[model samples]
Target: MKEKFLCWQTSGWGLSLLLVLPIVAIFYTAAGESDEVFSHLMGTVMATYTSNTFWLVVTTLVLALLFGLPAAWVMAMCRLPGEKVLQWALVLPLAMPGYIIGYIYTDWFDYAGPIQIFLRDFFGWHSVHDYWFPDIRSLGGASMVLALVLYPYIYLLARAAFLEQSTSLLQSARLLRCTPWESFRRVSLPLARPSIAVGLSLVAMETLGDFGTVSYFAVNTLTTAVYDTWLGYSNLNAAAKISAIMLVAIFLLISAERFSRRKQKLFQQELAHGDDVRYTLSGARKWLALIWCWGLVACAFLFPLMQLGYYAWHYFAESWTPEFRAYSFNSLQVSLTAAVLAVVLALIVNFYRRLDGRRMTLVPIRISSLGYAVPGTVLAIGVMIPLTQADHLLNDLAKSLELSPPGLVFSGTMVAIIFAFVVRFSAVAIGSIESSLAKVSPSLDMAAKTMGYASTRMLRRVHLPLIRRGCLIAGLLVFIESMKELNAALLLRPFNFETLATYVFNFASDEQLELAALPAILLVLVGLVPLVMVNRSLEKKH
Candidate 1:
């Protein structure tokens, strides 16, 4: 009875409040506004935004699968040396913000950049029309930049699913003389389908939520359209309308993910076993495997870090200022707070769901995590609309109650910003914590209870002690995510607030890459620590 009550209070109300608040707020704001805004949006940017957003999503998804699957396959199936290191190294790119990659790639591939410049000098071509070259700021360039940074989500999840396959299953295939590639296609891909779906879902969400890269490349996706409506047209009503459209799109995606995973099951093994059965790769194939792994790391991690380093070296002597200190503090505070809070909320929700022993938890937990799916600008609008309404409602309540209203909860405060982070990132934390919880045998809980320990004690003394590393991983994932978060912070931050990401964004928006370089570098550096820790934790578990 007590356990059920706890579940109701935490997952029931707390999570329920979070789940419904922004949604309700959005509807209410739409209702309060006139229908004239919708007509205006439909006439202008709506069709263009919808088309661009759809194409970008499709392009990014296709590229991510193409680039991510082979690498995941190579690292997981082959017995190549450094394969262990490659598994962890694949996650390094998660530390780099998508926009930062945009900034670097734009410069690196521009006509005046080294690549095109070298081509020109080599061929003795002088004028712009002398040679044909693709523009890095095009829709195609946006897709490539996004795929490079985002494929890690696919790689990590797919690799885990690949590794988790039973050796017995593969051995049976080998008895029939099936090639490893054939076996992977027949056995591995089907079994690994769930993880691939999950990874693809994440990629889709990140692609949608992206603002910096799309906006930097002048790709008029839905996110950038929202900005134009709000800032350029000075029409908040039209912005809210478009944002609501985006919210519905995200909700549909959440529904689709739910439908896909509904019938899927995770096969639980009865015992622990080490993966000592290894196959050898030789000669040309061996070199190919090593090259594949190194090449991915180069594209994902080394390239971006080197670019940031070069920019920092060229610009640091001029860009450093006392303003950097204030921005640094803001970034650290927001990232740490958001990461901690999101992880804590996720722990409570996961525990309640576990105690109840219902697969239904998957629904709320997944939906709560859908903040990742909604564009950050759209999410900010969703969050801000509700917060502003809540503030207005509180002001009315204050007059009626003759007391102060709880205006500080969200309006132009850290509370609103942090709440945005929780909604956006709780999914990542839940993924980590749920994975840790899955590893802990249920018999341990039963054994602890039989020893006269209650549920609280079991969690504190047993589960927490065992899953400390997972909690660290979950927290660190949240931290890195928050460090690069831009759209939400840009829209929801209080007047005069500046985090490292937002500070860099302001400079980058002015086409001042030299000025943005320091904060961007710092953002990547801070993000790397948590990312490295996540990779290390996963490796230790393996």
Candidate 2:
């Protein structure tokens, strides 16, 4: 038993350390000097990068809350028409990448596009300075684009929090002659504040991590700066230093969020799963709520999706080239590989914790999960630092042995891309499997042990059967996340390699998003699978 515990416990810690190695390498590499590149960047574009990143995170969070909070409240509090469909439809935006939306909107709203042309002709305006129109390629536009997709994070959490609130507290507020709005403001919103904070943290982190939308819109943020600093300057150390800055910012953001909830002791009971607990809206109120919910769905998901469909239909022959086929296959191969590896790692560390519930056992799971919180671009740079070093060391060792150095094996191949994906998304798998495992009865473990079953045998026979559904869901979730991953893929892809994300991003960057519509549609359609599955699981849970 002691030997068995030693094996699994060390295995768990080893997996955690593998995930953490890149992050630690970032700090170590940042500690090294880099030919005054850091100084030049500090004197030049650093302030602009920092300011843009700050405002982008702040504005995007506010906008996400603006869109998400009201929808969450209405969904939880009211009986609306087609409530079931609307609830899931509102989350469809999570399937659409911000860059795709940015591309479609920028084209539609540009001067040469239909909307602007109609405005100009209808108002009898001439060419230059005839009227003012909102630009879809600015910082504000990037924030809106990001907020559209990311608001679902806030919406999901806030609605779950509201649903789980104590009915007694809300009733007391109503008994004291509080209006529905007043009861929500005084009793419900306060209880859901922590959940909102968590959601906001996720939104802000994603906004900070974003590369494609902001880059396409010509807004220079830290994520863009990191990309330019490395590729343009060819300075890995400087990029690592910048990534270290991003890690610091992430740490502060996470710490502040946790600190805010340190004293919060709120607990909630589940909301009943029927219409009796809901208030039915009528007349203009009903119409307004319906408009609020459905309007978001149309603008965020339906509109962009329609635009992509239109483009794909019109340009199907041009868009579906041999390269498109290769990129699609590449995306599938890489994402599926990452998903499987991530699930295996999650199972290893999570089951270790299941066996031993010590504080030390928990450390491996937590440490492994830290990779998800690191911004994708930052994680990419961190991944490069150690892997590049390993590649060089291997080459030198090969040369010393009078053998040909196998070139660019780790850092310059699919290994890096898939490794980064696994690290970035392992947390999603861990959370899903850990939650499923927590629901399994401990008595079953004891029962199996008394029946002369070893840990591995019991896990395979009992827990695996039970959590297989969770594992499938977890793997699918990771696969979709890997498919949608843009920032890291852009940074870490092998030479002459392009996933669907990077391929479409390149097309959008080169002013040819029309030609990119087919792959863009593929990205959106792939992402929708997990969202629907997750929504179904949530429904079943309730």
lDDT of 1 at 30: 64
lDDT per residue (tens digit) for residues 177-271 in model 2 = 98878877888799999999999999999898899899889999888988998999989888989999999998999999999999989766676
* Weakest 10 consecutive residues of candidate 1 by summed lDDT: 268-277
Clashes of each: 0, 0
| lDDT to native, each model | 0.79, 0.91
TM-score of each: 0.85, 0.97
* Clash pairs (backbone) in predicted model 2: none
User: Which stretches of model 1 miss by more than 4 angstroms?
Assistant: 1-15, 31-34, 257-279, 343-373, 394-409, 428-475
* lDDT value, residue 318 of candidate 1: 68
Write one digit per residue (lDDT tens) for candidate 1, span 217-312. Answer: 999888887777666776666677778777787777767877988988877441135555445889999998788778878987798788777778
